[model samples]
Target: MLKNLKLTTSIIMLSSLLVLVAGCGSKKANDSKKEISVALNSELSSVDVSLAMDNTSSDVMEQVGEGLYDFTAKGGVKPALSTNKPKATDHGKKYVFNLRKDAKWSNGKPVTAKDFVYSWRRTVDPKTKSPQSYYFDGVKNYQAIANGKKAPSSLGIKANGKYKLEVTLDRAMPYFPSILAVSASFPLYQPYVEKQGKKYGTDAEHTLYNGAFTLKGWNGSNGEWSYVKNKDYWNAKHVQLDKVNVKVYKTEQTMVQQYQAKKIQFTQISGSTVKNLKKDQDLTVRKIPGNQYLVFNVKENKLFANQKVRQALAMAVDSNKLTKHVLQDQSLPATGYVPYGFNNSKTGKDFAKQAGQLVQNNKTKAQKLWAEGLKELGMTSAEFSILSSNTETAKQVDEYLQSQFETTFKNLKVRVAAVPFNSRLSKQNSGDFDTVLSGWTPVYADPTDFLNLLMTNNNNNNGKWSNSEYDQLIKDANDKYALDEQKRWDNMEAANKIAVEQAPIAPLFYISQVYLKDPNLKGMMLGPLGQPYYKDASYK
Candidate 1:
């Protein structure tokens, strides 16, 4: 989701640009007959909401699965299956949602509140082993249920009749609606899922769709798939695109070549290719709310466990050079874990600005720390591999980092282990790598979304960098200051500073997506989390 594997598809929440291809000629607006072909760099891992962990799968899920709420293109929330916004009660710990009876699953069965209840329970059920189960941390009894200490039925969600749903949380979450909008929070038809069992979401046929489109032509192992408009969807009339054909291209060069040939409507390009296409009218760029960072395996790697070593590795990379030369995608050098554009509600100041520069690029300081660390560890030299996705962008970035690390730090041998995207994810999740090129796209707008990943014992903490103070700061932000907006913001700022000072993960750059887009494609929406929504898109 780089919002989870939001990579351009990733394991620690990476974000990728949406690449579409369509006919070159001008067309009528809202052309219902029009269809567009697109490209992905990786294959979809799964469509099952509970099981999907990568950005590719999450992208597909976003198209085919309708949640209680949907993110608007303008970075706001809108009711989808729910009749309206839920009414919060019980001092903001309880929520009541009334469903729209018109909502239906792909099977033509009504989408009732029970479906939501079941979906939440299934995610937190230990038997499901959902990687996303930790998303329900504040939901009452969720942790116990996930830990196998309580029954899934005891989770604080219940269906009131067939249309109304009630949710009780252990603590108030002001951004709960954003959480609900995530694909992992989308409902699944119990009967259908049970019937499909392990086969569910393995392919298009085994899965069900209820959003703007239905997944088709995907066999779980193929490099291509289709999103066909769902006639049975409650809002089907609003979905203008008739079909979207998706294919996977292993390199940006191939995607750009397809764009140049007028065979595709959209594609993302990076590095020197972006410079080459700077004069092209079709070139479009937008800043996405995501960060690419270096993850250190502190739990297992003796060399990285030392804070000085981690700090040295982080400071060695010149983010400005990396983004300007190596990336050349206009991605901003990260100020900290949280990227730019997200603002404090009270002061309207950018969070990154308020936090100030936490990790600085200083070769002198890096060398000093490296020497101190080596001495402390009783080692003259160290060697380890940097694991990263085999995408062209990742390869280039890691290669640059390898050069930077090796040349800056004496006696440090950094090997680049470039594997397929999914394989890299597996190694990260299993804590199998020495250091990893990881990234995160916020699932929600709040700073907590990015900060939550590094907290001790977090499911997404692949590096297992733990600090009691850092954990406390995050906990206080979510729990003690949950109702106090200013306090929450302050605590999160503190936590961000703490994470940066410790340098378990080196915040490299804030992702700025560069795309080659056809001007004909109109009304295509990008969610706040960086995934594109094509429900409103049509060729013009």
Candidate 2:
């Protein structure tokens, strides 16, 4: 076994932490190798894509589920389960997909086109209460089904034959192919899902794999899990790794210790430990196409209901200092909700730079706004607590924000509710908190993915921010401007401006995926959405 490797400074990466040392030739993969172990910051709860919106679930889904398309290293779309790209017709509103004949479920049943139809319909079904169903908005009748005006079966997706699938959209979409690459659009075999009932996706046994890996040894609560290669995979001959193992370790110290002890190949490190990593040759810092922000529950908190209060709080955030000192990574201070890396469809310049700064440090203006907001509400004092994940890095950022707010406004009592990641998501979704730190990554490469969430009644809009003008702008961007590339791009930028001005969510910083990877690992392509594809990855 090629166990020991000394890291040099010749590593390469793009948006996420996938590195390969320069001048190292590829080596033949040894299929008899044991599972490759890595660290996960949070626990893996579900492989059901509809119910699980978090990153860990998405990671697990990629191992077990195969989508119509997958992403390439150049931020481009590529075919996965389908033989190639879908054929577009009806002015790009209709897409026909041809599945590979060899694709089969872990149970030895052929993976048919109808599996995609059933899985998509199940996601948009009102009974499922899927938080991620909003991803289907532009699909034909998807919004109607989600809004309870149409039946789930009415969703405009059908299997044309045993191997061909047809998808009808409400309008022509330029980024539809990219959207299909996300985990939310993947298929699930119908019979197994029905047999397992609600317990499906809760553990390894209940779920079946159709992708490159078959998950095993996870009982839904264990901190350790493994992804064994699927022998029945259609392209199993190309899958280089025999198995990949994951262990949940929240402490940065433990991850570092594990890596140094040669027990793992990669781990994410943050805080002061970043200083230590700069000297280590294995360090590779990469930006993820996402932004961290704070969402407020306007319906529950009267103070937060006032736009002036929200704006005041937003302007007072000093993200530049936070990213520089606290995060200590190469993360940038976010100018708006949309990430900085996305290119404008018209000008080809950066989207975030073109949109400009939505909110910034202006203590005097913030103070004036706060006073006006308090007077409008006829109150002198107000208090609110922030809900945040309990990870070490999250704790540092949350503590910084709490101290800043409490010190800035004497009348405002700011508290931090640090809970486990799953608990935090539950609390935020139920509208049980005054404020919470959250984030969103683009499902595709389009700016609309981040901008559309603030539209009226969007599923992820837990803040209950309703603005008719903002909603109209988003509608025009996704609907009216669908055909004109420049017009749609302009509308998306305008919508993000409205979201920033209203301050329902305060943009903080663009999150970076920091990795300490072994130099020998090759062919791991980290997609624009922060997912790593290891289909062709192998040790050199």
Candidate 3:
């Protein structure tokens, strides 16, 4: 009996040990299951949707800030917080939207139409000092409010009851719905903003989200942030990922290292790294429209005030070689303000080629023009500095341009000034630099977004290039009484022609976006608007 009892006890002990071992193994497997990690080259500048400018911060905010409308992977506009498409009335000036009753903030407060109205008013209010105030020009009285001549209440947004929101545009904008899809134009929760007061959006606790994810742990200065699934999100059932991990690195080398270590699943590669990773299974490259150019400070430098001098400087740079050899992305050389893929009509020759023919490559013509401009300005040798961000890519491009301009233009001394990105932007905005390198991704898939950036009165027009004709063209396009697509296109194209001919801004090649994705990841989509959609993104 004793021997039998000993054997049975041993069997029970063995069974318990096996159960514990299996439990631990299962837990390890669960932990090892695939999770998506993204490594960015910069830190989040701000979580405030209206203030986000950089890609890294914008990417995170897109997942956290729920817009009434969203762009799908297939480039189709879809409803997110809205129940359906907005209704237009009063000759396209007024818009009515019905919010989803189920939409709630991450803090469990009901999201109402008042939230959008408050957000719009705040963005246009002069006291807010929003860098994106230019976007509100489409709204009625926004310009007056931004100039401090009108009250914020005069802005054209209203709340009817608890769920209905109304907006009045200064003019009919066919792309208005698309504009709402951008984070910069998205609505913020009013109560949440008021509750946080001055601390709003500086930390994870200060902001409220109504999207698929809610920020859990984030300090503004640190590069590390994590987003956990929002249980209160109206469409939480469709959210597949449990969490998203974002790690920021200032350089691509550091990001690539983390990616190689399997700590991150996605990154952007360029230059030598692009060549090195060409054969990697996870590497994928696509040609997208992004333009980099040198904008002359005509307001500060009299040399750039002359159209011939501007044109001469533009002609001196070999854009084709810069795109083909330096960028190595098969990028088409730029010759106009609007990018080729940026469409204003349904049919035409590619914009890039058509614009290229208008401005032919001729170094001899450029030299003569430069000589004439020098005589007009009464300067023996033109000396001006080009300011750019201190990124490695910017450094390389600056060096290349310095060599090209010095070699081509006789009696010209080109100096490069590199500063941090934020500081560089501040300097450019203050008109403290002679020339600056910058680019714009259109807020919508329209030519106006790019053209409007150079308008004389536009706040975002860093170059401060002003012309009555240019302003008139933009004004006519925005006249409340007119609603003609063909006329609008003509006016915009005319403005673009003027911009190119005047050469206040040098056109550069449209950039191609390159991103790396792991084999296990799926549903990751990149849009022409330059925003990443993570709503449907998942990993196996």
Identify the leading candidate in terms of lDDT.
1
As a TM-score, model 1 comes out at 0.92
lDDT of 1 by residue, 370-419 (tens): 99999999999999999998888889988999999999976988899998
Q: Which 10-residue window of candidate 1 scores lowest in summed lDDT? A: 2-11
Q: For model 2, how does the per-residue alpha-carbon lDDT over 1-540 read when each residue is reduced to its tens digit? A: 000011010011133321111111112122224346665787776788678677777767767778888766766666788887855799878988899999988988999999999999999998987877888888999888978899988998999999999999998776677668767888888989999999988888988889899988899888677778898888899998887777777788877876766666667777677777888998877766678899988888998999999998998889998889888877788888887766754566777888888768787888889989999999998888889888888889898888778777778889889888778878888888899988876666667777777877787888888999888888997889787767777787788888888898989888777767766667766655445565667765
Q: Compared to the true structure, candidate 3 yields what TM-score?
A: 0.87
lDDT of 2 at 363: 73
Off by over 4 Å in 2: 1-34
RMSD of each: 4.4, 6.1, 13.6
Task: Show model 3 residue runs off by greater than 4 Å.
Answer: 1-34, 195-198, 203-205, 216-218, 344-356, 480-482
lDDT of 3 by residue, 1-540 (tens): 000111101100000000000000112112544345665554466788766655555667778887778765544467777888766788767888899999988878888998888888887777776777777787889878877899999998899999998889887766667667667677788877888887887878788888888987687667567778889988888888877766555566766766666666667666566777778888766555456788998888898988888898888788888877776645567777776664434344444544454444578888899999999988788888989877666777788888877887879999999876657767877788999988765555556667778878776777788999998897887663146655766687688788888888987766665556666667765543444456677777
Candidate 2 matches the true fold with a TM-score of 0.92
**How high is the lDDT of residue 346 in model 3?**
38
Local lDDT at 525 for model 1:
73
User: How far in Å is the alpha carbon of 227 misplaced in model 2?
Assistant: 0.7
